[model samples]
Target: MFICSLFFIYIGEQLDVEKNLKKTAVLVGNAVFYVPSIIKMTTIGGIYLLAILLPSFLAGYRDYTIGTDVLVYGNIWFHNAILSNNFWNYLEWANNSSIGVLYATFNYVVSRFTSNVHIFYFWYSFVETALVLMTLRKNRIDIVLGMSTYYFLFFNLTLNILRQSLAMIVIVWGFNYVTEKKLWKYLLIILIASGFHSTAMIAIIIYPLYWIANNREKLLNVFVLSVCILFIVFSEKLTVLALNIGMLNERYSDYLMNSNIRGGFFAHLLFCLPILILYLTAKNNIGGSRDSQRYNGFRLIVAFTTVLSGFNLKYVYLGRVTQYFDFLFLLAVPYIGNRYYVKIGRYRDTLVTKLLIYIYLITYWIIIYGVQNSGETVPYILNFN
Candidate 1:
């Protein structure tokens, strides 16, 4: 699994070749102008297509044991629950599950074509990874590094929490709209994303953070600090209120009530410290640029996720809430590594910082996926029989 992820990372970086080709064309005249065009073919020409395909194929071909939900939930829905002799009859079953109407409808439609779960897996993985890649490309961030983060942190996650994975990706794509101040469009995207997973509804709070980041930066900082204290003090009352108000379902309400795993509070807090320091120091580095604004907006998002991390101290399910925003770290860490600097005896370089960031992310992957076996995705299983 790790080797395949590394291979995908290598191929994903090939996206940089497009920019290099464009530069080469200008320097060498029309001789190589069409070279980039040939690569741009949507079918399979560019490295971009190959990058998306390899991971999707690997994910799609995985056997049931490869992920916790494959045998338990996803394949069940794709093969039986959403399939019926008459397709329309399964809507009642679909509507009964926690799944959103759109995703259930998607499964029902796919089941009509065939009951083979592998094909369903392939198409779903394809769309999910494609959205991720397209979002990185659109943001003009480092696609290679963004993909590296995704491969480490999120790709295996998509294998288990299938529905929420789609929701999380949609919300990640919608982060740009939040920065752009597109209220209705962003809200609509959130609404659509919520159809995939109810947890995505929490993302609606992000735009307000964007507003406060731009208008009241100091207050945002104070709020982040206060969040831990307040949540710790009133965690029970807040959980009850949220459940009574229908913000959380019965399942999560029960889970929250039973959750006593409070040991990771400090670990979560420690995780936010370096990131908070990076945001505070690096703001002035890219002063007054659009990237600065976007970075500032995402920093507050990190802050918001920190507050959710605080909630996880008592109500551990808020951990899922934090996962929706994890992709931003890919953007934030790389941007900080490239842009943040320090003066050391009149010598300064970001190369060391970038290398450190890579080491940290890879170590995180090893610990969470390799050691902890998150999502039960450590042993990559192939379905060949």
Candidate 2:
């Protein structure tokens, strides 16, 4: 994970350099600096060594976990799905006959040649990490920072849900496609992802709505009201429907019902209040432009989604539907910290500012990891070894 973070930072810096030769040199330099000289090491030890070296080697690297999902899922795909030939059974269950046959053929070919699942895990992680890097490139955020964010680490490392993780990668890639107005390409990606996990179908729904959400305020109210009503009137039905979908296992269902929505609510509240306060204090600061308006609209929609997580666990359990919005809070809080509070001329580059940001990010991670690990709500079956 940490080596991957360094790789992203190196790529980001090299993105600005001119000439293909210089770019190639930069890539080689990064690999030489980062990749180990040792020919062999245990996976866990290697990961630990990289983690320790990452921050020292790349001062600007932020821990991102987008690739973690692929790593976990790839482990599962290699061990349970391919090794045991269960992937065909899953495909058969979905009535994807052609896909089952293709997967069977691939599995047979691989098993005839190699028995090491770790190799498969590594290859899958590499490819998935590349895909995630590409998606992050489209967003123009710091790839290292984006990789380190809670969105990637918590779900990928802790939850260790493989199919859903792949689905998320697909969703991220789909977002890039949709944003570029490549509808057919976006749909194709979504379909491919859905083969891995049905939850990805949600992306199909979210994309069109994201496009239709032109009237931000109105859309906010409608989505909030609709979710609330859906919870109140159809929570049971929704629960049953989720069960029918067979995406979630029994353990996850119990977690949704038993866990305290209050803490989640409070977290959302804390996140939303800051945004609200910032908006009130700096509404005029935005200078009233179309882009500003669009940003504001995005803020509101995300804030509303965060708040809605508190309204119903059913929604949260519905494949972390609310989490898609939670990313907004993650991005917003940092921006707000830097924009409103840090820029008051009292704390620019000061120890206090840095400490506050560090503490906030650390605390955020602790809270997120704590809540996730609070119970056996979800399975952690990754081949961490």
Candidate 3:
């Protein structure tokens, strides 16, 4: 925890280096000794490297006890693949078990050279972190803020739902394809991602979501409402369809099959209320902004999330599918705090709004990591022994 604290501090300091360069120069006048580290920390190359590597180091060297899945599933899967008599047997097992082909193939290939699961974890962490940062970079987003948000929210996802995490990041990176209307390219990427986690195929909706967003603004409202209504009405049919298509997988189906149809409608709506409010407030003002297209695209994702949350009333396990879209809040929160209009929201992009946003994010972080321990990533233990 102390190490993670320092890491965040370092990242936080570097975030405003470009903006505060003059102030930094005045404070450190004639301090030649501090120049190199300061310059390195502020540069794109430097932040990119540090952000990816440091988290990879922390997540990779962690004990299996940190995430429940590490002990219960990831370790077992890794050892089983590596210890198999032959590659064919391993492939047979993976096929029978419904493990994603790409995920299984990754394990098999890595096991060929080294059976050390930590090494496997390190590389996995590196690739996943790199892809996420790369997406932020490609979109010209504030990488430091994006990475910080990811650390607080989705980083633990890499540890718990390894395959789905990989697939999710790939889909995140492919957002550009959707915005560009590159149907084939986007579908190709989705296909590859689906090879990692079948549920990733559900992200194909982003294309149409963006299309709907481009239509009359009121159309988005109507379409989203309709989706929620349709999903609720057909919730059971949809679940059965998902199971039939092998989207839910056997392990999940075994438990969810017997689970009650507890309406989580209010719970999800409450959880998403903040972002939904932010989106509607920012909507009227963003038409003239440079990032308007990006914002609108993301707005559709928000609407989709709303539809999914609404459907959560009938089928609780449908919540799992929402994981792919929930990350929009990490980017949206900062965007609203910084760019949301004063006329509409009355926040004026002031420090007060920023402060409130951070407080909200931090509160969620504490609730997830400290209180609920959703991913079982608490009392952070290193694999030092």
Candidate 4:
């Protein structure tokens, strides 16, 4: 956390957007001259540019902190023997119980290295962050606004949420496949992703709804209402099904009926209000009439996640599931912000033009400083120190 702060300060001082953007162009599909054609949110491309670069380089360096998942997963390495005869025993333990096969297998395979835990953490953070950054940019979410939310809100999560973080990465790409109308590709990807975390199957559940959102805008209002009702009614059954399938941790069984898991209360508030405002705005402005299927896809994802947030308010584990889907907010916020920006004019440098940046900063503070689980990052330190 400390080191990250300094890095941010250094970034604030030394980072030059215009120069670095051109420098990083080849890395970002080499769209240098095609800026006007490619851009959707702000013309600046600052946020998308940062998302593309920041996590791949910096995420692996963070030290563990209080309330962080790192302390738990990192220690798993020290507990497991490298190539021990008992390795299969550990596999049996995970497989027979609730741990998804891929995560368990991933841990065992990576643990072959002496420093597998740190390596695991690093590679996981790198791949997860990179996938999301590329997805946002590919989907044409305003790079600047989307990336701002990525840093403030979602970045720390890649440091934690060890398993679902991977699943989130898969679904972000799955959205691109969804937009492209590649049916088999979408199904195959989401199924494989579920192996990392069972909650990812929620992607499958919401996939049909995504079609409804994009193809039938007139049905959108009804579909949106149905999603809300369907989720509230079936979320528990879905939770039970995931438990039975071992997609979720069996340890969370108590939370199924437990009322104490008032998780994501504030987070839900943060996600829902903006989503409602945006949904209404989309409905009123473009509504079903808008021609951009990408925008429709964006709206569907946000709405799906927003309804999931309501379920999250009921239970923390449910909220965790909601979170994997809710990451669409990173893309959706910028879309909405860009829509607003378009009303006034295209993405601009004016403070009023970039208000989403400010909102993201405030959200960043709330998550990092306010939430117990969220404030999990510590200064960067090699695992051995």
Top candidate (TM-score):
1
Q: Residues 1-385, candidate 1: write the lDDT tens digits.
A: 4355546545545534554443323234545444454444332234466667778888888988886667756887787644476655666665555556667777877877876788788888889878887787687766666677677667877887778789888988877888889999998988998888766776766776677667756866577546544544455566578778866555656543432222245545544555666666542445566867777677877776676666665666555556656656756666677666644566566665556566766766676667667566777778944
lDDT of 2 by residue, 53-117 (tens): 44322211212232333343333433444445454565454233222232233334455456665
Candidate 2, superposed: residue stretches over 4 Å from native: 1-90, 93-113, 150-159, 180-185, 208-213, 216-294, 313-319, 327-342, 345-359, 370-385
Runs with alpha carbons beyond 4 Å of true place in candidate 4: 1-68, 71-74, 77-81, 85-93, 215-228, 241-249, 254-263, 282-291, 311-316, 338-353, 371-384
TM-scores of the models, in the order given: 0.80, 0.59, 0.79, 0.70
Candidate 3, 317-349: lDDT as tens digits: 666667667755556555665555434255454
Candidate closest to the true structure, highest lDDT: 3
Q: List per-prediction Cα lDDT, in the order shown.
A: 0.66, 0.45, 0.67, 0.58
For candidate 4, lDDT tens digit of each residue in 214-287?
56466675766586557755777776787798666766566344322223656666656665555555322234
Kindly report which residue stretches of model 3 are placed more than 4 angstroms away from their true locations once superposed.
Answer: 1-29, 32-47, 85-89, 217-249, 255-267, 283-290, 341-347, 350-352
Question: Which candidate order results from sorting by lDDT in descending order?
Answer: 3, 1, 4, 2
For model 2 the TM-score comes to 0.59
Candidate 3's error at 287, in angstroms?
A: 6.3
